[model samples]
Target: MLSSKIIMTPKVKISYILNIIIVLVSFTFGFRYIFASAPLNYQLEAIGVHGWNDIIPEYRNMITTFVRVAGVGMTTASIGMSIVLFRAFRYGQNWARWGFAGIFLAHYIPLMCNMFFLKTTTESNPPMIPNLIAISIVLLSLFFSSNLKNCKAIENK
Candidate 1:
């Protein structure tokens, strides 16, 4: 019989925890956007901010639709990726470690850049710090983990 045991190193444990965080956060945001988009859009329009009225109605609707679709797609992808990462980590798949690392970085880098570089309003400011810190911790934990090193070695064999 094939052994289906997962070795739990400190790094692997940390990675698992971070993955869970990622899933939870993604799901939270995903559901929030999916359910609240209409109201949120209306609220933005009411505030007369974020150039809500500057754009033509047709273009505005297109943008809103795009954002909603993207939000749902991202949420689904994140959940699927979380499951895949969990299985990969359990089976000691080196590629999954790298994949997760890459995906995490890709997903958050733009947000971080926008948070720091672009001028954010009161509405946007609240989530910036918490999100940055959380993402930083996850990235650091994943990169610094010894599990990645072991996985790399395994990949070479």
Candidate 2:
């Protein structure tokens, strides 16, 4: 019988904790967008676009549709990331390490850039601090999980 246990170092433990935080935060925002449409509405209101649904029902519907779709995407992706992180990353798989970083960068870098992009076009102040903090957490997680040499128990498997 093959045992499925992998020993955890301090760095790996920290990585696991950070990954959990990422999943929790992602799910929170995702669910809020999906169920309440609060995030996009907040952004719209910040830009002084009040009563858009009353003034322009069609446009509001379209934007709401987009927000809900984004929410679904975020939620689903978070689930996938959790699976990868828990099953493979904790085992110190090299592929999982790079894959997690790549997925995070691919998903978030463009969104962060778009936030700044929107700032130039609209009067809205994009939530830069939260995005920065999220990126920092992910980077720290990656740093902790990378180049670990103590995962030899499962390294050859």
Candidate 3:
């Protein structure tokens, strides 16, 4: 039947769901953090404040560039990934498969610090919530990535 033509694989379905969730997380928390979190953290007297006495551009450049680059990448990628996720639902396209993998890596791996500890660089750096969401997304993606049916199997030119 036409209704049964779609695969409805749980793995692929979960991956699609997680992709949507990831998009929301990025747009809400990630975007807000990019615009405000770093400056707020620096403003905190408790964060070991060093005044603008030296104003060393090298150190400033290093730290600021790292934050800015990562923030911009997250913002742009989240938007793109959301589009890809929608495409996956309809056509199960090759780009979405690979895109999901990349998003999983970028969002998830940074959460794992060393073997045990987790690193969350948000302003509050709130206990485990930030990283927990990321970890959950990672697990979901891994469980449902449908990587076995990746670009190689699909006809993409």
Return the top candidate by TM-score: 2
Which stretches in model 3 have alpha-carbon errors above 4 Å?
A: 1-7, 37-47, 50-69, 111-129, 147-157
Per-residue CA lDDT of model 2 for 32-133, tens digit only, reads 778854346546855577655554667666777877887887788688778778777866666776667666677778878888877777777877789789
**Per-residue lDDT tens digits of candidate 1, residues 3-33?**
3435567777777777777777877777776
Compare the candidates by lDDT and give the number of the best one.
Answer: 2
lDDT tens readout by residue for model 3, 1-157: 1121234466666776676777787776556646642433433322345553344667655555555665676777677767666655336554566766577567546634421231234233323556566767656675677553542223334
Instruction: Please identify model 2 stretches exceeding 4 Å from their true place.
Output: 1-3, 38-42, 45-48, 152-157
> C-alpha displacement of 3 in model 1, angstroms?
6.4
Q: Count the backbone clashes (under 3 Å) in each candidate.
A: 0, 0, 1
C-alpha lDDT score of every prediction, in listed order: 0.62, 0.74, 0.56
Ranking by TM-score: 2, 1, 3
Instruction: Give the clash total for candidate 2.
Output: 0
Residue pairs of candidate 1 with colliding backbone atoms:
none
TM-score-wise, the better of 1 and 3 is 1
